[model samples]
Target: MQLVEDDKYGWSAKPSSCEKGHAPKEISVDFDEVYKSIILPAINLINGTNLGIKIDCTRGEDLLDGGNIVSQFLQKICQAEITITDVTGFNSNVIFEYGIRLSVRDSLNILLCHEGVKLPLDFAEQRFKTYHMGLGGGNDAKDYIVETIRHALPLLLAEKSVESVENLFRRTVENATGRTQERRLMEVFEPAPDLLVRLLNALNTICSEANAPGDKKVFRLDPKLRDETWKLLEEIGKTMENSSNLSRAIELYELLTKLEGFREKRRDVFYNLNKLCSANPDFKEKAQFFLERGIELED
Candidate 1:
C-alpha cells in the first residue's frame, strides 16, 4: 500500500501490487495540523520501504453513505492495527474514540497531545506522548517526536500478547470476592513504595539536568518518561491522601503545580490542592486560589 493524496481527505492508502493478496498494515490517526506536518512525516521516515503499511484518518465528511458516524468510527477503531489519538483540548469525541480503542485493544493505542494540555481525570493516569509546537523553531520538537515513535513502534509490534482493560475488568470480577475485590482495586492504583521512590529519584535527576548550566541544560524529557513521571506523581499524591497524610499529598500536588510544562495546565493537581487545602483551616485562602485556578484551566 502507498500513501495517496486526495482532494478531500488529507491522506489515504492506495493498494500497490505487492499488497494484493494480504490485508494492508494500517495506522489510524486523529487528523490535525500536527499530524499532517509532524506526526505523518515522522511515520514516513520510519516506514521506509514498508509500502504495505497505510495511514488512515477519517473525516466527518467521509461518511457520505448515510451510515451512522459512531458505527463507522467504532469499526475503524476495532479494525486498525494501531490507533494514534490526539487528546489535546480534551475533545469529547476524541476521548470517546480513545476509550473505545483502549477497551478493545490491549496495545498499539498511542495518545499524543500538545505540551501542557490538561487531560481529564479519568485519563490522567493513561500514558501519552506530548509534542511541543513552538519549541526551538519546531524542528527539535518534530525530531524528538519522530525518535520516540521510531523507538516505540518496533517494541509495540513485537509483543506476542496483550491484555485489554475490558478483559482485566472481567478477570477481576470473575476471580474477586468482596474483600479481594477492594484489595485488587487498590493494588491497581497503588504502586509499591520502592517504585515510588525510584520514580521520585528519576524526577529529581531530570530536574537537576534541566537546571544545569548552559549546554548541559535539558529542556524536556522523552515523552514516555515525562508521561510516566506525571502519572507517578499523581499516584503518589493519591496514595498519601488514602493514608490520611493530607499534608504530604498537598505538598506533592503543589509541587506538580510548580513544575515546568505541568504548572500551566495541570487541572488535576490544582483540583486536588483545592480539596486538600480546604480541609486545613490555615489554608482557606489558598484553597480558594487553587479552586479559581483550576476553574480557569478548565475553561
Candidate 2:
C-alpha cells in the first residue's frame, strides 16, 4: 500500500531542512534494480537455508514520513535488529542516516559501498564491503554479503534464545574458538521424538501381539530402563520379532536406516530390514533397494 502524509510517522509539511538540498537529496528510486541486485537475492538465499529461517527488509524511503514521524522513524531505526547501510555514491543522507543507526546500535550492522566510491574518513577504522557492478566482475560483492549473512544468521538466531549474560558469553567464546562450533552442536543435539514415532511404537506392540494364533496372549516381562539405550532398542526389537509383524518391523527398521545421524547401527538396521522383507512381498524390493543403498554408502 502507498504511504499517505497523514499517518502517525509521516510529515505533511515541506521537506525538513535535513532532507532538502544536498541532504534529502533526490534518491534514485531504482527499486527494481535494487531488488534485482541485492534484496531479493539475499532473501532467497536466507529462505533456502532450511533452518526455518525467515528474513525481510525494506528501504527506509519506501515508508511514510512526517508528523512526529522523525522520532518514530529514528525509533524504528533504533529498534531494527540488523541494519545494512550502503555508502554508494557518497550520498550525504545515507551517511547521516547510518550515523543515526550507529548512535542506537554499534554491532549487528554491516556497511557496504560500490567500488571506487569515496569512503568517509571518520569511519576509517571500520571495515566495509566493496561491491562491483557491470561486466568485468564475475562475482558481485553483494554475494559476499549474502553469503556472510547466511552463515551468520543461524548463529545469531541461536543466540536469541540465550537468557543470561554468562551463558551468552560462554556461547560467544565457543563461537570465537571456531565458526563451526555452533553448527556442530546443532547437528548433534538430539531432537525429541515426534508424535508419529511414539504412535508407531505403540502400534508395533499391538500388531506384534495380535499375530499369535494358538496360545493365550501373554505380554512378556521386559526389563526396566537401562542406562544404555541401544541395548534397549535391541531388546525391544527381539521382543517384537516373536510376533512376526513384518510391516511394523520394516517401518521401525526403515526409520533407523534412513537417519543420517545413525553411525555403526545403520548396518544392523539394513540387516533387520532385509530379514523382515521375506515375510512381506510388498516390502521385498524396497528392502533390497535400501540394502543396496546402505552397501553403496559403506563402500
Candidate 3:
C-alpha cells in the first residue's frame, strides 16, 4: 500500500485514459515504491522484446470502484492475469494478496525480493527475481527484475495474445455451472486444509467405490454430503496450492472429479491439474489417466 512519491505512476493522479478497442497487457503490482520504480522499466522491457505487449500496471488502490477496500484488493489479486509481488519487505498485506493470487491461479505470478532483505524460509527453494529499489543498483535493479520475468514468462512473448490463468479458470468454472449454481457450489469452503481434504477424499472414495455403470441415473450422495464435499475440496485445493503443494492439490482435485454431483466440475478440476503439471512431469501422465477415466464415465 506504500506507494512511491511520484506523479507518473498514478498513486496521487487520476486513472489514465483508456485506449479504444485496445486491450493492453496488464499486471497487478503488490507493494508501492519498489513497484512504482519498476513500472517504466517493465514497459521498456516488454517493448524491447518486440512482442507488442505494452504494459499497464495497477496496485490495490487503483481499483477503488466504491466497494469495500479489502474486498476490492482481494478481487484484484483474484482477477489479475499476471501479478508481480515484491516480497522484499514481507509486508503482510502483500503476502496475503500473493497467497490469494496463488490459490486463484498457480503459475501466473513473479516473486520479487529486495537486494538485502531476508526472505521467508518456507519459499527458500522457490526462485525469486531480485531488485534494488533505492539500493546500489537502483534502476539497474529494476532492469534485472524485468529481464528475469521475461524469461520465466516466455508465454507473454508468444505470437498470439495469451489468456490469463484467472480468465481461463473463471470460464471453466462458469461453463461447469450457472451463476446461482456456482454460488451454491462454492459455499462449503471451510479453510482447514488437512481436515477438508480428509472429509472430501473420504466422501469421494465412498462415491467412487459405490458408483456403478447402468445403476441409477447417478450414484446419489446425500444432498448435504454432496454440497459439503465440493466446498471442502475448494478450500483444500487453494490451501495446498498456496503452500506450493501442487501435487497434493492435484490429488484433491482428482478426487473431486469422481464425486456424483461434481461431474460437471471435471473441467475445472482438469484446468487446475493441467496448470500444475508444469511443476512435476509425472502430473501430466497422471492428469491423462484422470482424463481418460472421467471421459469413459461420461460415455
lDDT of 2 at 256: 42
Expressed as tens digits, the lDDT of each residue in 104-142 for candidate 2 is 444356665555555558665678775554553314655
Model 1 residue pairs with clashes = none
TM-scores for all candidates? 0.37, 0.40, 0.41
Quote the lDDT for 47 in model 1. 60
Q: Give the Å shift of residue 168 in candidate 3.
A: 14
Model 2: how far residue 262 lies from native, Å: 56
TM match of model 3 to true structure:
0.41
Order of candidate numbers by TM-score, starting with the best: 3, 2, 1
lDDT of 1 at 110: 60
Winner on lDDT between 1 and 3 is 1
Question: Where is model 2 poorest over a 10-residue stretch in terms of lDDT?
Answer: 1-10
Q: Write the residue-wise lDDT of candidate 3 on 1-299 in tens digits.
A: 11122111111111122211111223222334454566555645665676434445666556634423443355445544456665654556556656656665554466666555656687656776665534444466566656755674454332222223223223333443464322223333323322332343355455545564555454545566556665665555544433335554555566566666666666655655554563466566765765565565553
As a whole number from 0 to 100, the lDDT of residue 52 in candidate 2 is 58
Predicted candidate 1 versus true structure: per-residue lDDT over 63-82, tens digit per residue: 44332344434444544444
